[model samples]
Target: MKATPADQQELLRLQSIDTRLQQLAHKLGALPQTAPLAELAQRETAVRGTRAEAIGALEDARSELTRLESDVAVVEARIARDTDRLQHTSSVKDVQALEAELASLAKRRSDLEDQELVVMERVEDAEVVVSSIDLQRAAIESEVAELEAERDAAAGGIGVEREQTERDREVVAAGVPAELLAFYEQRRARGAGVGAALLRQRTCGGCTMTLTGSDLEQVRRSAPDDVVQCPECDRILVRTDESGL
Candidate 1:
């Protein structure tokens, strides 16, 4: 395919734009915050599970405390009725029985109060555990929000540049002959995004290999309008003053 020398040079510009766009896409996907954000999500899930266990422990402690309180209440009620009877009765036998029963009730109340104290401590400890887990979860959530904001900001900047680059490509591509542009596109797809390169200082710019011997002689013999492809890389070679032919 024959394209004017000027038209061929525009392919290098198009290639540069395409390369920049590819770099921008890679940068957007590789933002530093992406990995940490994913890690934070997993941490939050584990903390939630721990919080659930702590809550269950607290509930169990509270239930035990409630049972102990009820037991103490029943013991105190019995002691009160027995003391009232002792005050009214005059028989010596009844006095002894009432005194003994009062002593047993006092012992039972003391034991129940002791049990309640222990269970109350357990409840307090359980509450502390739950509170600590809540703080951990909150911290993870805060970090996640921060990272998401950073990621979004970075993506927004890249997106703006990409849009402008695409516009630039459209303008540059419009000037090329239809046949040449289509041919370049096909070569670009097969050549890793590079359809044309400058033949600079006796080197094939596409492959960065210097042309020598018959290869150099062949390119030197070609006409200015001839579409020459590199024997090594098959990319269209656009010659210029720097080609060093």
Candidate 2:
């Protein structure tokens, strides 16, 4: 294919942009914050699970405390009834029975109070667990937010630059012949982002293989308007005065 020197140089420039675009796309995919954010999300899920368990424990403790307090109230009412009987009855047997019942009631009430105290302590401990989990969640969220902001701020500039570079590539590509650009794109796809290489100092910039002997002579003999392909890697060999041809 025939291309003027200027058009050939434009192809090289387009190649440069495409290469950088490929790099930018890779960078965008592998943003620094992405892995950490994912890890933090997993930790967040685990922490929320812990919080859920803490809530369940607190609820159970509160429920047990309520039931114990209710039992204590019932016991106190029974003792009051027995005390009233004592005040009214003068029989020895009746007085003795009432005192025995009151003593038993007192013991029951003491046991319920102890159980209530234990439940109350569990509730307090559960509350502490909830508080600790909440702090952990807040710290994780703050770090996630910070990482997200950093990723966005850092990527913002690269994103804009990539967009502009892509636009410029389009404009430059439009100036080239359709067949040449298509060929370049196809070769770029097959050659891993390099369709054309600068033939500098007898070296194939695409493959880094030096052209020598008859190969170098062939490139040297080629007309300036004619496009040349490297014999080793089959990439377009773009020539300049520095080609050492």
Residue pairs clashing in model 1 are none
Name the 10 consecutive residues with the lowest summed lDDT in model 2: 2-11
Model 1 segments more than 4 A misplaced: 34-149
In candidate 2 the C-alpha lDDT for residue 26 amounts to 90
- Give lDDT per model, in order: 0.90, 0.91
Name the best candidate (by lDDT): 2
Model 2 stretches astray by more than 4 angstroms: 1-26, 158-245
Measured against the true structure, the TM-scores of the candidates, in listed sequence, are 0.54, 0.55
lDDT tens readout by residue for model 2, 1-245: 88887778788998998989999989977998888999999999999999999999999999999999999999999999999999999999999999999999999999999998889999999999999999999999999999999999989988999999989998989999988888888888889889999999999999999998999889888899898888988888899888887
